[model samples]
Target: MLPPDFTLLQVVPELETGGAEQTTIDVARAVIDAGGKALVATRGGRMTARLEADGGRLAQMPVQSKNPLVMLGNAARLVDLIRNEGVSLVHARSRAPAFSALWAAQTTKTPFVATYHGVYKAGSGLKRWYNAVMTRGDLVIANSDYTRDHVLAEHHLDPDKVVAIPRGIDLDRFNPSWITPDRLSELRDSWGIAPDDPRTRFLLAGRLTRLKGHMTIIEAAARLKAQARNDFQILFVGDDQGRTGYGEELAKAVSDAGLADRISIVGHCDDMPAAYLLADIAILPTTVPESFGRAAVEPQAMGRPVIASNHGGTTETVAEGVTGWLVPPENAEAWAKAMERAIDIGAAKRTEMGLTGMNRTRQLYRVDAMCAATLAAYERVLDARRLTGKRP
Candidate 1:
């Protein structure tokens, strides 16, 4: 017999190389792997390749256009597509696309799902209403308990409607044992580091947004660089995402600190596992609470210690002394002090922490575990709909 014919549509603003975008691709692949029809609809971006490569169909839609008329047109287009393709459920990943998906789901009586991936702050009523779409999903997915609580506090959404499905990481891809020595050497060389260098490599991976706390990290690095007792390299691996000026400002800060030789911005790393393997430590210094810190978990899976700002999902992912350190958010001094602790811990202690982290991540945050939970949630949603004899 053929596999069950349930169609799932994932709507997003764009498919770029970020935590959320990567999850979209992974979830799409998971749906197909589970013998379902996986369809991704978006404005189109870098992530489309993985979606199509996973044997999922891509439906290009400018659901991200902010204009009222454009959103209405997108809604109509979505409605037609949903009807034509017999989409069983429509999932939206962002506000712009959520509006269109909401309209289409309402019109076609399909299940509407939304995943809240960030701690979105509302500036005004209009912005709050715009973000309300996320809470309106038939079955809302919160990337963390922190994110779930935010939804309840901000939108007054029902507790039952909001389900916590923490973001998943691919264990197989991130396994330290799987990372080849040649790959590590290649990445080290590409980053302009000598293979024989005794200096530890520290990485800060994220888009160069103000919220990422690049300046804060740079300040911390300067302190480390100035210390005569320490030797280390800092690699900032991510594109600026239209924040060229911010990137330049950060570069200037590094230059002014006289740490230019040890600090480099390596843009858009394609081989993240290799990059993580080369790192002695990973840092995430976000000013805002990350709904889930993928950077924290990925490197842990690679048996590299991670240090993150103490807030949001990192509270659960990074176990202070067990996995890595968690410093006060946006404090350069605190970050620098943590860096010193990391450096002082010695190789044997760091190795133990990395091993503990690897086991912890495998048990709790594996991609397969995430995918299974998601599908189980979908089943529950469908079952509830059947019982209620209601159509969204």
Candidate 2:
């Protein structure tokens, strides 16, 4: 049991719809359920209301600013908040906020934790130094084994201080049993998928950006179409994030390949569980390494087969021929062949694979497990602080 007065303050850029923000809300719910106060300091977004509903308080702050002067002011403000709120621990999820939270935690003599949520690329000394703040946590959390290895290779830290904890999904939300047929029909209809159509729906979900391999998937779709394998429909679901040029390029590519009818680029989806249920196979053809690909895990939780690039967090989350298939990154031909294989697997084998993935997800990637591990880390830091009699 947690101490009644124990409080944890998590800092992030915004309460938005992403893996980090979702984890922030999950941990906040865990802290509350454990009889402790949970506080989040972030610029508000769509998830702010949900966070509050889950018993987490929002302390609005511009911790997202990267300006040196603004960051210094943020550090001072965070220190004041820590002291006034009697915060027992400070946790940060992004680099900009981590700097301020790190300074405040040190100044207030409070335990600090940081979650490495991205595979931060640093091609220069200054960038490397900026990225080093994540490794400065009293206890550093890596979202995957690949991420932990990246941290160990890039940062000079005691290996024992770094822990790899994969991001978890809320099984209650992603469960296939809870999603009704109406929900599936609603998503399919929104995507213009005909009720009697027998074509397999291949879904690639993420921001409509180059790094997500939208071009690569488009190329793969072209390859499949050229092979006269037109029994599949490829769907790209995500916001363009105001990248009109890129969206236009994608549409032109589809037109050039004569696959405009076979491929559709749909915008942001509100119900992911239903979306997953509507997909025959989910794809994550990323060009760069992901820290922890929630797209890979969420679909699996919904009992859908996945086909992700053979790299990064997907390497750990996806099993070959069991949960899903992994193809070479950025290779259209390879992706096309994999898609063919998925189609050949037929409905029975696909159901078997989905069942395997569902079981694996339940055993390893549930949100409750992540919360337990995170709280355990916090307890370690708090225990040390108690023994040393540290105070602001």
Candidate 3:
């Protein structure tokens, strides 16, 4: 055998610029780079442009619909797409699309894979069963060791079938040298912050959702009013993504805390590397466990002290005291304490820790490393199927 030529099909709700969306782009790019065909089948969105720009074909369909009738319709459509495109593998990034993709993959006799992006905390029995399909992937890609273990515990799947492949950031894109003070200053100009000011910027980047811990960060910042108020400014980045009501809640929390000025809701940052450079500290104060904390790693690679709540993959992302501090999840007081310590420990220790973080990022979380590992898993599954003379 020759290196098997695979027409990879990625099914997701929409091509939005979330972590899973970004990962889908990565996989498609890798497929083309590795001499395979990459075809993404999804309801097109903002990210669709970039997906096609990178030499991947986009097959648009109403994949976002979740109703049973809509899903079965989509499955029939996907089966047609797969058969016509000669897709050798089907990958679903969300549970909604997974229901359709699973049926399509089964019908087409293609390998099925799932990238478990978030921890689906089952609110009810039906929901739990619905989320359980994440465990049914021929190869389940978890973003972190924390997430891999969580999937094992919650879904009760074979550990061998679940693989930990953290979200990857291009080091060159996130490198400290790549973003300059001039660029950082330019972003500050837009944000109305003085370039010469010695004040620190504590940045939080994510959708303005309740689970993301914006209120918790604001509350913590308010509690720290007596300390680091002048030097530290909290900046929230990320568009509401239809969570305007939640944004209102955050605004109310900020107002109640009297941190209206100090806590800037800088929605949807465009230049994240520059945004990281503009910050003295980076934090992901999510209440629930993030399957993998993509927000934490970029700042670390940029040599910024990152403080994330001790939930989800944050424990794995931040090397505790080495990269930054990890406070108890949702504990505003504890977050306040950690923020104080991270700031008060002075710039020298911070620089040392930041360098350590950069080293860890360089060693472990390179995009190429992630791509290689992921491709290996795909090949393993394919080879097993080939030996058995069965379609995966």
Q: TM-score for all predictions?
A: 0.96, 0.96, 0.95
TM-score of 1: 0.96
Compute the lDDT for candidate 1: 0.86
Clashing pairs in 2: none
**Ranked candidates (lDDT, high to low):** 2, 1, 3
Count of steric clashes across candidates, in order: 0, 0, 1
TM-score of 2: 0.96
The lowest-lDDT stretch of 10 consecutive residues in candidate 2 is 383-392
lDDT of 1 by residue, 337-384 (tens): 988888888888988999999999988998887878888777776766
lDDT of 3: 0.85
Error in Å for residue 119 of model 3: 1.6
Q: Write the per-residue lDDT of candidate 3 for residues 1-392, one digit (tens) a residue.
A: 21656788999888866788888888888888888888988888888888888899988888888799999999999999999988887888899889999999889878888988998888898998999876665789988888788788887887788889988877888988877777877789888887677766789998888888888888788788966466678899988877689888888888887887788887877688899888889998888888888899989999998999887888888988889988888898999888888878988898899999999988988888888888887887788777995434
Better of 1 and 3 by lDDT: 1
User: Which of candidates 2 and 3 reaches a greater TM-score?
Assistant: 2
